[model samples]
Target: MSDQYLVRIEGKNTDIAVEETQSILDAALRANEWLPHSCTQGTCGTCKLKVLRGEVDHRQTPEYTLTVEERAEGLALGCMATPRSDLTVEPLGNVSDDGVPRHPLRDYEGTVVVLDDIAANTRRLVIELDTPMQFNAGQYAELIVPEHAGARQYSMANPPTETRRLEFHIKLTAGGLSTDGWIFRSMTLGERVSLRGPLGQFNLVAKQDEPAILIGGGTGLAPLKSIVQHALVEDLVPELFLYHGGRRREDLYDVEFFRDLEHRHPHFHYRPVLSEEQWEGATGLVTDVVVSDFPSCKGMSAFLCGPPAMVDAAVKALKRRRMAPRLIFREEFAITPATSTAPAVL
Candidate 1:
């Protein structure tokens, strides 16, 4: 029996070799075959596909995300399923050309230049890469956890122009393998780490005319920061509004950075909202504040990144305010189970 199996995509002239140890999605992306995916972990069901003709070992696929009935009905998560034999699969989501630039996946090694606590429970990590990585503004990279045999996904906070250095805002999770066990506790500056590049499809659309509203919660601000910087540099939008939400003032970081941008750019606006503590700026939920500011979002496009609850609420609020469904893009920060030693999404 061959250790590697050939997997063919339905209706596409694409066939890739998948090692028995590799996930189907990993191999597809390495072959430059774009597929819809968010968190590369098994948490998000975004990578769900139909296994048309072969067997797959659905390893580590969460039951909550991929139900037993779905598996029995020929459904599998491309991020978690490993080929048991030669396969034929069809991605559920459309992978048509949308004019967004897709950077090929590659491995890179980097030294940790800076690591500091930026917020209450979040830390700012900067890595100087050995080779430059080309990525879309909102795409993410996966860092291999030393000695853990797993990797955690973190969005680059810097713009794509800074290809030689990668910036990440990571929120520490209690007892997390990559967080508590490593980044927050044992990791040090000048240390080296391995990482993979330019993952995820949540990115800025090309040639968009409408003003953009970016909302972020906790460390979810990482990718939005990249987007805002890129947009301002390229003048991608007529106006840009950034709202970072936190439970208290201590939870918010980069206040001065955004304030400076707002001061310099007449079209840029920055709002920091505190939910648990009363602040001089906006209060209550971030989504509520946005709703109050924009009576109608009919002519605006929005990018939301945050916890699932917050993202879901923002989507609902924007939709009620008349924002078109297609104009709203979101990325939910999916935290892994505390007990499980699996790689998590930040």
Candidate 2:
């Protein structure tokens, strides 16, 4: 038998060759078949698909994400399952004609230019790529962590226009192979690293008319910063409000930067909320502050990024204020199983 098997995407005229050791999602992506996915790991169930035929090796698929019953029912996570034979799989999510632009995945080499401690346990990492990567604001890149034989995903903090230079806000995770073990400890300036470009579907929708409220927690502000910068530059929305939440003042970074931005744009507002520590700024849970600020979110859109609990709270808050379900977009920052020792932060 051939080492490679042809996998067909049900309902689409697409057939991609998948190596026995390669993931279905990875092979489909390389073949320019866009599948709904986040985390690119087995953690998120976004890439779960129905295996219409053939068998698969569900390598490293977490039981919490894909249960035994689901696997028995022919469901497999595209990101973790490797084809055992020729297969036909159907993505559970709809692949629609949404106007969002999809950029092909590519590898790039980058050198660390600036690495500084930005917040309490967060660091600002700037990498200058050899070639410009075209990506929508709020998309993320995966840094290859060869040391642990894995990769860590981080959103681009800089605007999409700054294609050559990418900025990432990395919160140090205890015992994390990419954070404490590498970036924060032994990594140095001018060190070259390999990374893949422009992953994730979370982004500022093009030509949106409703005002946008962006909420972020800790380093989750990275992608929201990119979205805010791009939105303000392009005037994509009528108004923009950004709320960065932290447990204390030490957890918040880039306060002055957003303040400066607000000062220049009359339609833009910035609020920094602290939950654990009392400050002159907005206090209490970030989602609570948003609720207090906006009595009605019926006509506005919201973007949220943070830990699962925070994101879940924000979503509930927005829905309570009558925000349409389709208008609310969120990205929950989480560490994959490989970095299980780390805290749940982007």
Best by lDDT: 1
Which sections of candidate 2 miss by over 4 Å? 338-346
- Error in Å for residue 188 of model 2: 0.4
The number of the candidate with the highest TM-score is 1
Instruction: Write down the TM-score of every candidate.
Output: 0.95, 0.95
Model 1 TM-score on a 0 to 1 scale: 0.95
Q: What number of backbone clashes does candidate 1 have, counting pairs of residues 3 or more apart or in separate chains?
A: 0
Residue-wise lDDT of candidate 2 within 1-346, one digit each (tens)? Answer: 4389999999888789988877888777767788888877778789899999999988788899999999999999887888899999999976776888888777789999999999999999999999999899999998887555577889999999999999999999897788988999988999998888788889995978899999999999999999999999999999999999999999999999999999999999999999999878989999999999999999999999989899999999999999999999989887765433211111
Each prediction's whole-model lDDT (CA): 0.90, 0.88
Cα-based lDDT at residue 72, candidate 2: 96
